[model samples]
Target: MTLTGHSLIAGEAVAGTEGRAFGINPSTNEQLEPAYGLVSTEQLRAATAAAADAFKPFSSLEPVRHARFLETIADNIEAIGDELIERASAETGLGAERLRGERARTTGQLRLFADVVRRGDFRGVRIDPALPDRTPLPRADIRLRQIPLGPVAVFGASNFPLAFSVAGGDTASAFAAGCPVIVKAHNAHPGTSELVGQAISRAVRDLELHPGVFSLVYGAGTSIGQELVADPAIKAVGFTGSRAGGTALMRTAAARPEPIPVYAEMSSINPVYVLPGAVRGDADALARQYVASVTGSSGQLCTSPGLLFVPAGEDGDRLADAVARALTGQAGQTMLTEGIASAWQQGFRSVESAAEVELLARGQAGTTANAPAPAIFSSNLDVFTGNRVLHEEIFGAASLIVRYKNVEDLAEATDLLEGQLTASVQATEEDYASAAALIPVLERKVGRIIINGWPTGVEVGHAMVHGGPYPATSAPSTTSVGTLAIHRFLRPVSYQNFPQELLPAPLQDANPWQVNRLVDGEAEIQPR
Candidate 1:
């Protein structure tokens, strides 16, 4: 596939008539060729209009057909092969091996949603058959099923270009939910976005689906993203980026005449609490794993453990020493972008200048413009509580270790944290009582809590939740990963006294889809 520097708008390779932007190689600090033209207001309107026009037919398609379409998209993405991986690596500075794994994760998520569609569980079909033969007040013949919430605007993420970009989970779940999607390509990886966008367009065409079923737009700044969110034709949005960007979209979506749901995955520190027993048992091994998680992907993941809580004593000192020793051999790595590198530097400076924070260790500095030196900082509970800036996300390979005097101090530190995508406890059986006490506090503070595990790698599955309350994401009830994410683009509609012909197949008495559904308050699996 050729890298056309054109936006895939309404199934056509429409050239953006606005200003142009080029993909920058973060590792080399060099601009990539074939400048991508930014989309104009008119083009944005046209794309949304096309998606709105396509929504009816797209959403009304049979469940089986929807499943097939999703599978086709997965196939098309895989067909892109090495070209996709190479472009993504060059554009974002992510290694080919990592890109290949991300590509598999992207396709795997698409196929998982396909299976979700085939199973028909996302429909949320429920039936309460009317009892006309009953008392004076007979129950009305009512059935409920989830319907698509029309067109969705997806924002490509800077990190994980393939897995979180144009054809990533947000788009996949939206498409699986039968909603038309218009993705705003991330500026950092325009070439990768173009390739994946073209692949999706090809799948839409090969399936003979609506041309407007998918579209990709490019922009140099926030104008296009804000306009896309404010468009009345867009019913919901999916975003993965910084807190400022996500909150800006949330405000825009909320201020619109007809407000829409914005599932914006924003910031997360993903705190890890190291219980005293666990820290005492094998601090060296724990330190090794902790350093690995923080340095993985240059600490670009949302679930990266940015803050670690440990008991202040011999155990804590041992852990800190182990981390310092581990940091000596670690080397600086190239981040996803120069802007991110700058932000990391600023965040590191903030931590370094804090009154009680101590710079425990520093890795070898990188020789390139976008490379960042990994650093570990330590502070006591008093200093951390007094300084809110210490809690902010650095967005790079930097973490802070907060030493607590006791379990109460640990709980206090945990309470001070903002909402996070995940919180982990490195504990053993002996620490269960202490770990159990922290679970309640963590439950309210984060979405997922892991025991004796790292929080960096997020698995896309049925029960996985890549979301949390408040700053972690715009909407806590919905997720941007896994099959449940389909609900973000869906709204339940109850059909009252509708004839079989007028009702959806899953809601009809025939139960054509043969899906498990609630009937009169009981779970039932009806035959086709």
Candidate 2:
């Protein structure tokens, strides 16, 4: 199927003059289409400047109106569901079924942000009333609410092209907070991004949003990215990619005269632990479940279980055998891009070269460019503890099995883990008792802890935590999932000593416009 390609700037399809860049099909190693032009540095500057200007009026819009705009965008995304899936599959080499699910995630996220805006959750508004008659001194009445941070620079992620690209959570959350967006399209699937950009552009027109509210730019190399993040107009950045890529952008943001927040979720191993009782009772069952985790989406996820900790014994060996057998006949899967495939191959080789580990099952390398085979390895706790190299993430269908001599060794291993998005435990009652001492340490190391379950299926709910320290994400306290994600796009401001007539409608006297807030000394919306 033919796909159209263009950049959306100021609600129009603006073509770039730079040389073309090609998007290839990973499944067949075929060229999917002719190259598209990279957005010139001039275009990048213009897009950011436009967004900066757009933020002035957009951020001041009434909360209800902004919420309506978000609702409209969500509807528009849902209306074009089929087109998004088809283009995303064709452009990114993902299967149609997988793309369909991603489309839902993408639109669902947009709608979730709409709910957040309507509920004023991101506002986080608080009021502290004056006590003029109190002792000490007359206290001042102060009202506080979150304000939009301004224009945002979003770097699209390669995986989940539909959900993490142009119209993904980062862009959606920014818009929901009333900040304009300048998206740097991912090179792996520019065609899919263009289609989504068009839909967003339509939403902007239908909602009568500012022309410069959103802009799409395509950058082929380091120069475009550097320019995007370094610009002063960009109040913040959102990125999901390799550690190296995220770090580079963070450094750029830091070096700027006025530094901005960079929300970058680089990589994680998403480790899992299996206690002695569980390994002894049903090592085979646990191994089968884990095999599915390592091979899910060919293990091309940030939450993929890269490390497995097990008690060393006859049972542990039996579980290792089970895992080896399960992985033995598994077929390879299509990776997101050639760069990722190459990186996965290199990362796998690095683990195999480690003196601390032993390879249990070696997956066959693919003859084609996109396919990634499954790989499994085994090692002792001492070896892994002594070597920091064993802790890094390998972004592919691979798992490293670590055998601990005792519960103490398991505790030590848990203590050594860096911050992660999720950690799982496979434990029976006896095993749970044995590892109960380590739960606190594990809790500190990851955002979420699971029992007898995989970590890849992240639920998009109010309680979900998708961020962790350092490598997992630059901002550990903030999530890139759920309505809370909008917090990244806002900062709190307090208004004091202002007349009722001068105050914003949300905080005006007589309880006009009936929204929830602390009025006078009480929490009520009734008329004064």
Candidate 3:
């Protein structure tokens, strides 16, 4: 498959008027062929307008067709094969095995949403029969169901290029909710984004759906993305990146004449609390696991355990020593980009310069431009509690061990944390009684709480939540992963005293879709 480097707008390949940008391989620092042109503001408007035109027919489609459309997208993505993996691997510096798994996750999420559509629960249908014979005024019949919020603007992420990029979760969920999507391709992997974007376009064509159902735009800077968010046709936005980028989009959306929701997954230093029992039981094992989690994908994961809180004592000291020993055996790994690598180095230097922070260990040096050496640092409770810099996420291959003197110190540290995507407690059965007190605090601070586990791996399922409070995400009530993510692009509408023929199939008297629904506040599954 040859790369065109053109933006896909309304099913047509359109060239950008702005300057061009090339995809560079992070490992070798080599530029890939075919410079991608930046989409102009006019192109952005055209894409959004196309999406607005596509919304009604696309959203009003039968649930079965929606499921088939999502399934077709998964098939098209799979058909792209090894070329997809190679381009993504070169652009993002992620290994072939990792990209392959991420590709599977990307397609799996699409199929999962397809299943979600087939089940029809996303509609959230409810009905209330007319009570003409009862009450003083005779109650009128009412029906309710969730409807799509129109076109959505999605920003692709740099780290997980396949699973969070052009045709990833945001696009899948938006389509599942019956909204048209316009994706802003991440600059780091424009080729990869183009490939996936084309795959989705092929799916749209195969299904004979609206050509405006999906569009992909590339940009050399933020202008195109900002324009998309500010466009009147775009009803919502989905973003995943740095705090600065996410918050900027939030501000842009808020400043719009008609403000919209921005579901942005921003920075998170997922904290791991090491209970007394776990630290004392096997410090070596804990150290090994912690090191592996921190260094995974060069610590690019949003749920990476960047902070570890351990009870201060001989046990904590032993654990720190074990971690230092483990770190010495690990090698420096390639990051997603040169910018990220530079930022990691600067963050490591900042930690080293801190007065009370002690450098534990450093990984073997790398031979490339974008590789990052892993480092571990430790600080006492007093220094950690007083320094706000200690709380910021480093974004790569480093973690801070904060020694807490007692449970009170741990509570205080937890209180100092901002909202996070995940928070974990490594405890044994014996530590349950003590760990119970911290559960409520963890619940308030993070989207997901893990017990005796790491937070790096996010499962895509019905119950998973990849969102949290401010700084973690703009909206805490919604998730950016799993089947529930579809809800973010949906809003409910109630039809009162409507004719049976005018009602949507799901809310009709016959329940034509045969979906489980609430009737007069009671669960009902029977047709009519």
Candidate 4:
């Protein structure tokens, strides 16, 4: 359980000859001990080579074994206990309770994927029998099933270090798809990353699987990330970070000789629309909840509401006053790192200085070193349409209120919005007609639309989607959460007229895996 400041390359702790960096405590502005080593380009190459070597054996695992492997990884992560939580909290300025919840979420998703593997439904098996007695021509036998896309490269995020770090959803989904993974640890929480990486390595060692199934690498800067995506061994990528970082990786992936899919989750300002009826009734309660969502976790979540639309009338003025009153005197929370805190300050200031944007309320700053006071700004719908600055994401406890004339203005404003992860509507039964009219417009602009709720916490389940179009995510058809995420690392292949002895188990007539399939265009349902 001891911490070793070295990159783990395929179950081996490889010390880097490159430069080193230390994790800094943002709350105290102090450096943590045992600086983590950064790997050289050659070491990174070896890691990717190891992953490529493991692809065949790793991808060919049977149903029971593959399901158990994922479950064992979840057990190993939970076994780490308080050491993991304490280290994560110290590295990032998050609370112990929050880290515990994230740990449960990480393990829970792994177990969920284990169930998915056991069901054997992710293979997507289909078969078409030969019609030999046809009048003119005979149809040949054909079968199809999904296969793993070799090794995957996953980049961790700055926020939610546990749920989005090593062995998080990206890694879990890739493993569930029977693909090897190489994770580039987030520098903000190196110790946490190493601890979780060791847990995964231990699972591989105990299960007698290929050592190259997983690797955790560290590098000084963009060199390591660029080389990883360009490597032929890597087939796909899963990333979660800023828009700039995500787009940079996309460019690198596109420029390669053999292009790969990069599923990067970038910026999202998840907007909230307050209907006139709901704003007219119990505006104070709605204001309290709105303020809570805006300031939660210092507004560091990807789904935090950054923009809110309110009607411009006497009722709207009363709601706006309630919002300002609710946000006032609130204390700010500590941010993850010094760089993040600094960037947040710069972002809020840039938007605040824009024309037609005025500060409506300001909360007290925390006592911590990097914590800044939370604030809210107000503007008009016309200004929001013309001013591009108001549309940008400020990654902190800052939001903007845009007052619109009526439902028509609300719809028009929504049309100008960028693609987002989520959009919420605070409406009542009386406002159902207006809310229904905007559903189609919101559907085009966001991945998930919620009624009478805020967009702070994301649910992890079978139907959850943590993806969107363009800047929200690189791939619109996939999600980084839920069991559906496994499809990202899978590609379907059809076999024609293959010998019975040569066919794969799932596609064979005997149904060795006992999975349901579409036979002659009809689904053969199986018991779970």
lDDT of 2 by residue, 1-528 (tens): 234466777776766778777777887767766566787888878888888888989997776777777777767777776776776776666788888888788888887877676666456556777778978788798887788898999988888797777888899889988899998988888888877777787877887888889998887648888899998899999998888999999999999999999999888999898877778777667877888889877788888999998878888889999898888888778887777888888988898999968889866655556787789999988889888888989888988999888876776777777888888888777776766787888778788889878898877767888888778899998888777788898998889977888887666665444556655546654332
Candidate 3 lowest-lDDT run of ten: 519-528
In angstroms, the error of model 4 at 445 is 1.1
List clashing residue pairs in candidate 3. none
**Model 2 / residue 322 / CA error / Å:** 1.2
**lDDT tens per residue, model 4, 8-88:** 999999987789978888899889877889999899999999999999999989888988888888899999999999889
What tens digits encode model 3's per-residue C-alpha lDDT throughout 1-528? 778999999899999889898999999889988899888888888899899999999998887888999999899989999999999988988889999999999999999999888878889998888899986789889889999999999999999998998988999999999999999999899999999999999989988999999999998436888888989999999999999999999999999999999999999999999989888878888899999999999889999899999888999889999999999989888899989999998999888898899988889867766787899899988898798888889999999999888875677678889999999999988889778989888889999999999998899999999999878998999999998999999999999999989989898888777778989999976442
Clash numbers, per candidate:
0, 0, 0, 0
- Would you list the C-alpha lDDT of every candidate in the order shown? 0.90, 0.81, 0.90, 0.91
Number of the predicted model whose lDDT against the real structure is largest: 4
TM-score of 3: 0.98
Residue 182 local lDDT, model 4? 96
Q: Ten-residue segment with the worst summed lDDT in candidate 4?
A: 218-227
* Candidate that beats the other on TM-score, 2 or 4, i.e. the better one: 4
Q: For each candidate, C-alpha RMSD in Å?
A: 1.2, 2.3, 1.4, 1.0
